[model samples]
Target: MVELVFITPFVTGLLAFVLPSALSRQLLVLTGAVHLVLSLLLWKNTPQAWFAEYFAVTPEGLLSLLVISLLFFLISIYTTGYLAAHGLKSENIFTGFMLLFLSTMTMVTLSDHIMVLWIAIEATTLASAPLIYTHRSGASLEATWKYVLICSVGIAMALVGSLFLTFSMELGGVTSAMSFSALTPVAAQLDPAWLKAGFIFIVVGYGTKMGLAPMHTWLPDAHSEAPSPASALLSGVLLNCAYLGIFKTNKIMVSAGLSDFSGTILIVFGLLSIVAAATYILKQTEYKRMLAYSSIENMGIIALGTGIGGLGVYGAVICMIHHSLIKSSLFLSSGNILMGYKDRLIANTGQMAKQMPKTFVAFFAGFAGISGFPPFGIFIGELFIIMAAFKTGHYLAAGIFIFSLCVIFAGFARQVMAICFDTPAETGTGPAADGKDVSFKEPPGMIWPQYVLLLTSLILCFFIPDALYQTIVDAVHAIGGGLQ
Candidate 1:
């Protein structure tokens, strides 16, 4: 069953390469539904992995798997409509790679071995590169090149870190397999210096893939250039896959009693990412690029929360889940905006409420949710992270965190207002801006996914199920998190 989670997508992806474009597009949605069902079964039954040493259903991995399954399912629905309306030149390739991308991400979630995790994360970069180049334009080509080059370098660093971990095990006289499960119990015996060095390299390596600051140069280009459904997956779930590597490595650091050293580095990287994102987001001109920067900011917040540990870890998990839901919806809504206006510039996209009312609803609601407004899960998650920071006496960090959040919200809010309410001059001049035409109604598939995504984020803010709450708590507990 665990293998089926990824195998189903891989098999479908291969078939999509030969299938007719129309048929392959249908396969995209079908594969997503099947994958989602398998993930749900895994969650309910907690099945044992066939290859126990190489793969296992840990709490954090399961949470990530759930998000990937749900988000992919929704995004697939949107893709079918998007391809139909926009008419991609290479629809089959896009469909095939999207499934392959899903397979790689699923592999990341279930991987238990250190090197296997590295392989899976690197595979994701390869599988999604073509999706970024779907437009076949020079700009998209540049984005794809930067994405593959930068991520390859980062993954190579991660491989070096994995080797360092192996050396740590050898130094400690531990003969067990280099799997996360095997390492945790004997972590105390591992050399502290090697483990700390491994942790730093792993974080820096995977942090680059996760779109953490300074290393996130490739992200804005890739996200802005990729087709919106691909962008949604990249922002929503791909970053989490990279974070999973750092997260498992962090667990080893905790078990080895190097929490202080490892935690401080994470805090510094997290804070720097947020500040960097805030600075760029304020001056962002392209709407998609603005959303990309927002992803960096949210990833930073998640890292910061994880570093703080205790309740902050719990908050980090919550933020990760909700950010996936809301940010993906915003990207899909941006797709609608792009389709309508035929432009990515914020200044050119105004009076959205008057032109495309349904999209405006999803876009504005998503903006509010991402900006950490009340009645959204991000607001709750950020609240808990701040409370935990203050509780742990990180007063200066807390102050900086709040100030960054305020700055981000102010920038995001200004853009949202311009998109929703400000009137545009000669709106119908753009390719598809004449939304008043009877033929111009936003497609049901494109419009509904964003609605459903936003609503799920809103609902979760008020009511979390017992099982999910327990799963989140268990995930945090694995990383040395508690109420404190």
Candidate 2:
């Protein structure tokens, strides 16, 4: 099942590229559903390993793999309905590339070798480049340029970090294997100077890809320009892959008795991201960009949680799960609104419920859930984070974390309310009854996937089952020895 989870997407995508555009698109539905089934089987049953080069199931990696794979499945279904009605040309290329992207992301989580993990991370950058430029416009080209350049540069630094890690252990009596088990046992004897320097590069490098504040400049532009499905994955899965790199490095640091030094860096970057996100949200005119900033803020919370260690690791993992669901729903709803409004600016749009009731309501619910409203997963995740931070005596970090979240909430509330409620600009008033701005009604396929993601996230909020709790524990444990 684990092997199928990885191979199915790659094989299907290649086949998809050769078929007619419509046929290729429909195949996505079959592929997605099958992949989801395999993931569930992998989640519950015995471990299934592919060839040494490919798949293995670990509790932590399986958790991330399931989320990413499930998201791809839902989005693939939506894409079929989307392209069928809209008739995008040669979109078979998209399905093929997406499959390749999934293959690489799958490799990233499951790799036992550090070098293989680095390569997979880099592969994702290549596979996703075309997705960002799907429209072939000047704006999309510009966005793609920024994404490729920044992510490539960032990945290079991580490569350097991986190499330094190798060298650090060599200075001790350890033979380096780059396996998590192999690295942890020998970490304490490694050279501190080289390890510290390596971690800095890893954090900054992968941090750029994760959209962590100062390194996050490329993110808003990329997310704003990519196809909506692509944006959802970028915000949801891609960020987690980047974090896996940092998390793995931190685990090595923890084993080396250096978590205290490494964690401070995460805390500082995390808080800066929160502050930046709150500031940007208050000033954002484009609704998509605002959602992008919201992503940055959420990533900050994860960083802060992980930095505090202990229960904080659990909090970070919980944040990862909820943010993926909530943020993707937010972007898909943005797609619906963008299709309706014909403009991304909040001030330029108005009275969504009047124009399109289902989409408007879904958008509102997603906004509320993402902002950490009650009975939502983000609220629970955040509450855990607060408790974890306080337990660690990170009083200042905890206070800043709470304060920043409140400001972000206020900013998002003011904007979503204004855009969703206020009447449309007088200039663009009245339906396109005469056929002016918006032509098609909101696409049902797109709306349906978001609805699925949104409702599932809300459900997950009320129940944090033991399996998931153990998965979180194992994932944090994958970063082994960090807290203690």
Candidate 3:
């Protein structure tokens, strides 16, 4: 019955492919609502999967499930408005694939078996591929191929890594079930050499999907080319699904007393990602692409925090939740800007305060939140991470983290100001030049989802619900990570 959380979406997705366009659109929202209710129910009283060998719930997975559920629901409402305005071709295809994307990501969060987790992650790449190509532009086509090809290669490596885990078990003469829960207690008895090798491959593999550096090339292109709603899901929750894979594997490594090895690698990768984003962000042109790089930077921060452990893991989990909320809202707001300006470049889309006041509020607030400004959960999360890094004696790494954040914020703020307030020259070419023109009418549906997401993040910053706070603590407790 717990599987219904994903199954309902999967079934409706298939039906969406054949249903009439109008009905399919309605089905998308309906599915999202139903999925959210089911996810809440499952979370309320953790239920065992019928196929316990392949699926089960944990604190981490439940946390991811709740985020994915809420995001998809709000995004569904926004998509209904987006589709009507854009009148995209193959609406049915878009609806169906979006639902499928949700289902696959849900499965990834719930998967207990290592191979099953890999399968679900790979399925997410496949399900989201069509969504990226929905625009059907040459650029979109190219981006789709890059996403599929790169992610496919990365996931294949993950498969090999999963096999290495099993091989470690075989070499040690331990015949436990292949589930994470089953292997973790006996992980210390497995071959450490093979376990280390497996962890390396798994990190590089899923790290690609999670948008970590060196493997994050496909991410910007995919996010930039995908429709806004799809972009929301991609940056918002899809990356978290991939991170869950690494997190679970890291948990096993800690149980095996390989924490030092695993932690160091994560820290290195985390800093690399953050530094990489800073380099590109300073000279970025496209707004959506800028947001994409920001995601890479945030993922880096999460990795760094997790690697630091103790308070750091708690901070990383907080960053993960806040990032999902804020980034998704930013992407949705970008859609409004895209609709009004008919351009992706910040230079051409100036004077948003006058052209799209409502969107400006959401977009600018999201900008502040994402940049670690106060009154937002990310500010608290970042603060915790910085303090944790210092407490762990990662002084150099902490310096790099703080410096990169400053650099990224400076570059990001400059572009945002141009987008929000700069007046265009009287060239009669860009929309901003024509002071009287307002291309987008600012739909209530599109406007409100973003506000809701940002408001939720703001509320959580001041007061996290007791259950959610406990869940966050529970998630990190296994790996020598907790508030206490």
Strongest candidate by TM-score: 3
lDDT of each: 0.92, 0.82, 0.93
What residue pairs clash in candidate 3, if any at all? none
Instruction: Show model 1 residue runs off by greater than 4 Å.
Output: 425-439
- Tens digits of per-residue lDDT for model 3, 228-260: 999999999999999999999999999999998
Candidate ordering by TM-score (highest first): 3, 1, 2
Off by over 4 Å in 3: 425-429, 434-436
Q: lDDT: which is higher, 2 or 3?
A: 3
lDDT of 2 at 31: 80
In order of appearance, the predictions have TM-scores of 0.97, 0.94, 0.98
Q: Write the per-residue lDDT of candidate 2 for residues 238-290, one digit (tens) a residue.
A: 89988887887888888898989988999999999999998899888788889
Counting clashing residue pairs in each candidate, in order, gives 0, 0, 0
Better of 1 and 2 by TM-score: 1
State the lDDT of candidate 1 residue by residue for 28-96, as single tens digits.
Answer: 999999999999999999998888889999999999999999999999999999999999987999999
TM-score between candidate 2 and the true structure:
0.94
- In candidate 2, how many Å is residue 421 off? 1.0
